[model samples]
Target: MNDTNSLEPVTAAAVYRAYNGGYFKTLVSPEQTGGSFALLEMVLPQGAEPPAHLHEKEDETFYVLDGTVSFRIGSKTYIAGPGETIFAPRLIAHEFRITSSQLHFITLLTPGSFWDYFMEFSTAADAVPVVKAPTELPPADFLMHLINRLNSQYGVKLV
Candidate 1:
C-alpha cells in the first residue's frame, strides 16, 4: 500500500457529462488514491435506467447523499434514500434507476482501474445542473445491445 502521507484533500471536483445528460464529479481519482479506489459524486436525473451489468474487475458501493435510487442486485431490489448505502460486489449483476426528481450520490469503486469506464463513457463538462430534467433514453432493445457492446470493452458484462 502507498504511504498515507501521499494522499491529499480534494477541495474541488471536475464535472463530467454522461450520455443520459446527468453529471459525474470525480472526487478522488485512481492516481490520487494510489490505484486502490476512485471516488465520484453522481447527479442523476429521474427515470435514468442504467443497464443491468456486472463488473469483472472491481466492486462498487453507492452512498446516497440526497433523493432516492432503486437498485436491483441479483434477484433482490432495494430503495436507498439519503444516508443509505448499497454495495455491488464484482461479478454481481446489478442495475439502478434514479427514483426521485434527481438523485445525488457518492460512488466508490475498488481497485480503481474500473474507473476507466466513466472516463471512457463521460466527458468533461461545464457544470452539474441543479434541476435535473429527465432525458429520453434509447429504446430498451437498442440500449441493451449498446450497453453490452460498450461495457464489454471495460470488463463489464451486460447481465
Candidate 2:
C-alpha cells in the first residue's frame, strides 16, 4: 500500500471536456486513495444528460454545488439544488440532467472506476463537443459501440 497521507491538489487546468458538454476534473483518484474511491467535480450545461446506466462494481454519490439538477434512480426521480446530495448504489440504473442553465457538482465513486471511463470517453476522437441540447445529436453507432466497450472494461452497464 502506498502512503495515502501525501497531499496534492488538482487544478482547473486539468479539467476534461466530456462529450455531453460537461467539464470533469478528477480531484482524488483511486491511486491517491489506495483504490478506495475517486472524487470528481463536474460542470454540466442545461439539457445535458448521460444515458441511464449502472455500475456493477461501484457506488456513486453526487453533491450539488450550484444550479439545479434532476436525477432518475431506478423508478424514482428527484430534483436537487445547491448543497444537496444524492447517492446511487451499485447495480441500480441511474442518470442525471442539468435542469438549470448550468450545474456544478462533486461526485464520489467507491471502489473507484468511473474516472477511467470518463477519461476514455472524453478523449475518444469521435467524441463531439456538445454545446447545446443533446436531443438533436445524430445517432452514432460506432460511438455507441466504443462507449459500450469502454463501459464493459470499466464495469459500467449502459441501459
Candidate 3:
C-alpha cells in the first residue's frame, strides 16, 4: 500500500530514488498527499557535499542513517554520526558535507511540499550543463529562479 493509508508498516525498501544527483530518494512528499511534510533519504558518497542553502518558509530536520556527516547550520558546524539528528529552523542558513567514507541519512521537512521544490532543484541540477566547484555557489539569479519556480509550483515561497 502507498504511504497515505493502509495498516502495513512502510518499509524503507519502498523509498524511491530521487532525480536530483541520483543520491537521494523519497518516501513521501506533498505529491503523496496535501500533507504539509516530506521525508527524504540522502546518500552521500565520500567527499560529497550539498551546496549551502537555507529555507525561508520551511524547517528542515536531519537524522543520520550511517557514517559521519559535517552539518553546518548557520555559523556553527558539527560532525553528526549515525543515530544523530539536526534541525534547522526556517530562515536559517545550512549546508552539509559527507566527512566519513560514506554517509546516509533521512531528512524531513516540516511541510511536505518542500520536497517538491527540492525535487525540482535536483532535477534542474541533473539537467544543467555547467559544473559547480565544490566551494562555489550558484549565481544569485539562478538561485532566485529556482526558488521562484518552486514557489509557483509547490506553493512554498523561498523568499
Q: Write the residue-wise lDDT of candidate 2 on 63-106 in tens digits.
A: 99998988999999999999999999999999987889888899
Order the numbered candidates by TM-score, best leading.
1, 2, 3
Candidate 3: stretches off by over 4 Å: 1-15, 18-20, 31-33, 121-159
State the weakest 10-residue window (summed lDDT) of model 2.
123-132
lDDT of 3 by residue, 63-148 (tens): 99887888788899988988999998877778877777666789988877677665656543232123222344568998688667
Candidate 1, pairs of clashing residues: none
lDDT of 3 at 57: 66
The CA lDDT at 22 in model 3 is 39
TM-score of each: 0.78, 0.78, 0.64
- The Cα error of candidate 1 at residue 33, in Å, is 1.7
TM-score of 3: 0.64
> Which residue runs does candidate 1 get wrong by more than 4 Å?
1-19, 130-135, 138-151
